[model samples]
Target: MSTPRYALYYAPAADSPLWHFGCATLGYDAFTGEDIAFAAPAGCNADRWPQLTAEPRRYGFHATLKAPFELAHGRSEGQLRAFAHQIAAGLSAVPLAGLAIAALGRFIALTPAGPSPALQTLAFDIVQAFEPFRAPLGAADLARRLASPLTPAQRAYLEAYGYPYVGDDFRFHMTLTGSLPQDDVAGTTAALGQAYAAAVPAAPAVIDRLALFRQDSREGRFRLLDSFMLGR
Candidate 1:
């Protein structure tokens, strides 16, 4: 059997406009692991989009609740599934007021319009709850993370959680692009804002489900493995 890495993510429902727009923009569907053809944003170069979105497209459109990790030794995929189900049953859904397109460093992403304490709590809980199943970062993985300049708190989180961004450092973002060139940032940001406006509802977005995604290998695209409803 292939050793798959898993992650817990908050992806929009397949039927939602946000899902359609996100998948189209990225040109890859996490649910089906298929490439899609979509129009470029108005006044933008069509040829540049595929290259621009390539990195995030591999991971699909979702906010990371639990960063991807391989299963620990002696752990089974079934055990992880049951644990995720248990976690979902105990947590209530959070209602995000809205999402807006914004710059996250050099990349663009959809971020929550306002603070949602409930969302933060849920993300923190998932990180802690699933720590046991996460395999320790291999030497190469650890080295790669350490090579980046990180704050003390981020380093501590990396040691404790196998990922640097967790707990207080966590900021929910569904990535839209890889690092963009300086000249492209302004135009791309505006384009994303206009393109995603219809998909981001004026009303609140309800986070009522948690999805499990799997990647068959380090180079593979993640695909939806299963979904568990919240508050059940």
Candidate 2:
């Protein structure tokens, strides 16, 4: 079997309302690697839901802190895990206050209601700190990443960090659906808003830990390997 690729993700606590709701909506649990049973949102076409959510459901419900990457030539998974532990120990949790359902490009996501500089800094720091463990992108991977038109800076970041949407380009989001057709976006957004209303926290959601996720292969589902608490 191939060594799995790993990622650092900001997953909500398993028992939290957000976790339950997000997993139910996406219909997969990254932590447990299980398909969850959930009713379709009110007024939503059940048949269309699986197709709309297919992409995000596969990735589970979490914001990416570090995109998935294979380990460098000389590194082992244990070394990467220790490094992640050290990184988490030196950092503090950031308060993610007032999440709102909003359209992010063609899809919808749970986004912070206001700017959180601390959150941005934490993400940037994680990307930089873990770069040593990340193997450089292969030719095919690089080509696939650049298949879409990217700004010059995004291309540069891709070359430097192996992922385009890192550093200053990173926008924290827990994606709720795959890219929706223009005609379907508005209705889907409203349905999701109503369905997830109870799960939205009235107060701040503390980003207290970083989760390590492992994918058995490029085509496999990512599952939680472990979680390292912040401020340890």
Each candidate: what lDDT?
0.89, 0.88
lDDT of 2 by residue, 1-232 (tens): 7667999999988888899989888889888999987556788888778788889887788999999899999999999989889889999999866788888889999888889999999999999999999999989889999998999989998999999998789999999898989987888888888887855556767889999988888778889888899999
Compared with the true structure, model 2 gives a TM-score of 0.96
User: Candidate 1: lDDT of 181?
Assistant: 96
Best-matching candidate per TM-score: 1
Best by lDDT: 1
Give RMSD to native, each candidate: 1.3, 1.3
Give the distance in Å from residue 229's predicted Cα in candidate 1 to where it truly belongs: 1.4
